[model samples]
Target: MFNYAESIASRNTYMTSIRETMAEAQRSKPAVTISMDGDADGKSHRFYTNRDRLEGDVKIVAPADTRFDEIYITFEGTSRTWMERLGVSPAASGRTSVSQTFLRLVQPVNEASLPIPRVAIKGQEYTFPFTFVIPERLLPGACNHTIAVENQSVEEAHLHLPPSLGDHTISTFEDKDDLAPDMTRISYAIRVRVLRKKDTEDQPVVLADTARKIAVSPSIPDAPPIHIQDRSTEFVLRKEKDLRKGLLGKKIGRVCIFAEQPQPLRLAPNSSCPPSTRVPVSLTFVPANAETPPPELGNMTAKLRTSTFFSTQRTSYTPTVSRSTPDPFVGRYQESTLLSSRCVSNVSWEKQEPPLSSSSSSKPVYKAQIIVPIAEPKCKHLVPTFSTCFVTRSYTLELSLSIRTSKHSQPNLALKLPLQVSQPAKDSREHDSAPQDTSVEEFFVPRIISPSTLQQEVAVMAPPPPPPPPPFDRRQGQLPQSMLLHPPNEMPPPEYSVFRGTGGPPVRIPPPVGISPGCG
Candidate 1:
């Protein structure tokens, strides 16, 4: 009985290209419906309708131990035939003159659930009832063929029925390519699809809840004892009691810590904590080596006031420029010692203020054996030469003096007017005997140079010009006979005679006119 709805009503007469009013509905016997749902309800009598080709049939009834998943084939038209053929709503044009098929089974059950069966017949709708699921796994054991519905589109349609013989004898079974190479199995199927497409944007945002994993175990609380006091320091806290009892001042996350040395100490982390809170374990102390200290390290300190356990007795006045003698009760001053009186003394004073000295002079001219500028000053006293007030915040005055001179008082004399010895004019008139004559005159000039190959500097007159002195009184009362006719061996001979020029038989003066005619 292979009547899968009469073979999909003989394949809907090749579906639609219309043309089959069949003689106007056979002379009005009327009743010519064409809506669409399933099982080919187009009530045939050999009516072979056609368009391009659309053959249909659906009669999937698996509701017993239920097993037949998915066979949705909807095409019901009429909202004026879908606005005259698919303009909207097939549930809004998600395109579907639909068809889908998926079914797999081979024995399985757990409460045996199955539903996915819809086969309305012609007015068109087809499948989509429990949305297909028959996998309480294809029931009743001993599988050997039988459940078959494979049509998967040739434009769909083909699901005949009738086959098999149960208990593993559809003919000695086998046929998974004749399996028997040891037996082992698992099978099931029901996959049908279509109905996708819809994703306009996307959205997802979520954050703010910070505090990840912090359960410092072992009962929490071990690190609080740091008392560094050179200037003053201490801060010890181990808190975290209010496990969310009321919810008030909740600040979470802030710990500074820094004082490190041989365990100098640093523990800071308190901005109030509580959100997902777990920051306890504080121990603080800060102040290691304050001001200009090193007098065995004690300028006296106590400047502690941070997150308060109280401290501020910082007495450090190092103004000791002593020559000693100003102790109106222990000489130095900077007193404020007391950390608790309701503890609110946030004190600080770096005041040494007394150091602007030119010796702070007002009239400062006290000169006795005075010389005091402490920072080491030596003195050797004598009677009431008093002057010792070195007291400094900075002061320097070194003026020492001594005057002593006397050996009977006549030692103040400075007069030596005993230098007179004038009288040697025995014959101061012996200046009337003339005898003046000193002469030296010689002229031999020649020095001009231009054509230089470098080196030429001459000023030679070696030796000549000595006897003009024999003319003592021959000057006005003397001979003019050509100077008494030249005696010293003809002295009228030099007018122009010095012939020693031209140095080139020792030839080499040819290098001046842009000379490059080579050949030395």
Candidate 2:
């Protein structure tokens, strides 16, 4: 009634001016800027891989001369993940998060280390060029997951460098989408900090700071093929469908469509272009009678399934997105991309002659093998399967077939198989691998190990327990032994109390992560 809208607009305008003034003031301070030579624009993308040089320059400028105790640059990689629970009531649900800085490399630019003086001169500029070589593997302490498999350790699955993910940097409709959720992120950055001595002689005080983000996608080696269990949601290796001439027609016979899991998709680490792989499949046709033949095949469609797993709380094992867990902070998400759809033609069905004793038998069989040239992933922004403490990514190949069947009620046959996207394994850092022709039958042949080989692998993975330390007193110097065994910051293992409805001794529970992508 009293021109309330005009007053509100005036207030908003006043606040905007205040924010602009503050931002301008902040920008005028002694500024630090970073430039990564390889990137096109500032902070957009600086891509690097293992054993590559990350060269950059840091510049500091001030209107008046500024003094600093020391300048430090840190190359750090950090991972963070969060989960939100959806309960019947909003009050019951909550959000949980976890984070870790797994890789940290610090270099100090003290007065003695650099040629120029430490202070930033007035009206003049100071530049510091830095070069850091990315490592191939992380330190052993980077991951702390419990290992259950024989001849395996936390380093075995998680030591390799993880690609830069979840930042929406690679924006595309197809392969560019990392399939990662908004809640999970793995980031790498070059952080520079200017420090001045604190009056209390405690930790240093930061005079200024700036960071340049990096997009790192390390070339990881090929992992073993994923072991798949029988699940309707997982894979279908073989199936039979009844054939007919027309809609609601008589059954000519049943055609058995079966395929062996295709081989791993090998990818070049530094190829000139995005690589493509082939999917080999075998189909068997079993007829109801000798008069019946295989049904006409339609288009075979290929789709790539991307699965991402993220957790809010620390998990001692890999996370699975398909199964629901009671823990509120862990979850999984999935996305799919259509690769290609092509007409199924030029299939040669070879006749198998029956054995002499079975020649007179009524059974009839035919076999044909086919290889489908899978189309390249939609975009070049694809990341191979990799897992870190907070986030994990994997892939699956889905093949769907349309068959010309007689029965109107029959449905199309589909198969979901594990697809391991692999890169050339490095023999060493100096010698890059030149891939030669290798067998693509990563699925058809199961690994066989002898006793000696098993023993050797076990010795490598499961080392002997360390010796107990000498007794130490808490009051004298070191921390209490119990505190060393169980740190106060971490969550203890779940406990069973006698105050429960069913009273018994405490039962140990298996870790919550079950059936991750690569594991069975």
Q: In terms of lDDT, which candidate is strongest?
A: 2
The 10-residue segment with the lowest total lDDT in model 1: 211-220
**TM-scores, in order shown?**
0.10, 0.71
Highest TM-score against the true fold, candidate: 2
> What are the RMSDs of all candidates, in order?
51.1, 22.5
lDDT of each: 0.21, 0.70
Question: lDDT (0-100) at residue 466 of candidate 2?
Answer: 81
**Candidate 2 overall lDDT versus native:** 0.70
Give the alpha carbon lDDT tens digit for every residue of 404-440 in model 1.
1122211111110101111111121333233433232
Runs off by more than 4 Å, candidate 2: 1-25, 37-46, 88-91, 113-118, 145-155, 169-175, 197-205, 230-233, 244-249, 321-328, 407-410, 425-520
211 Cα displacement, candidate 1 (Å):
33
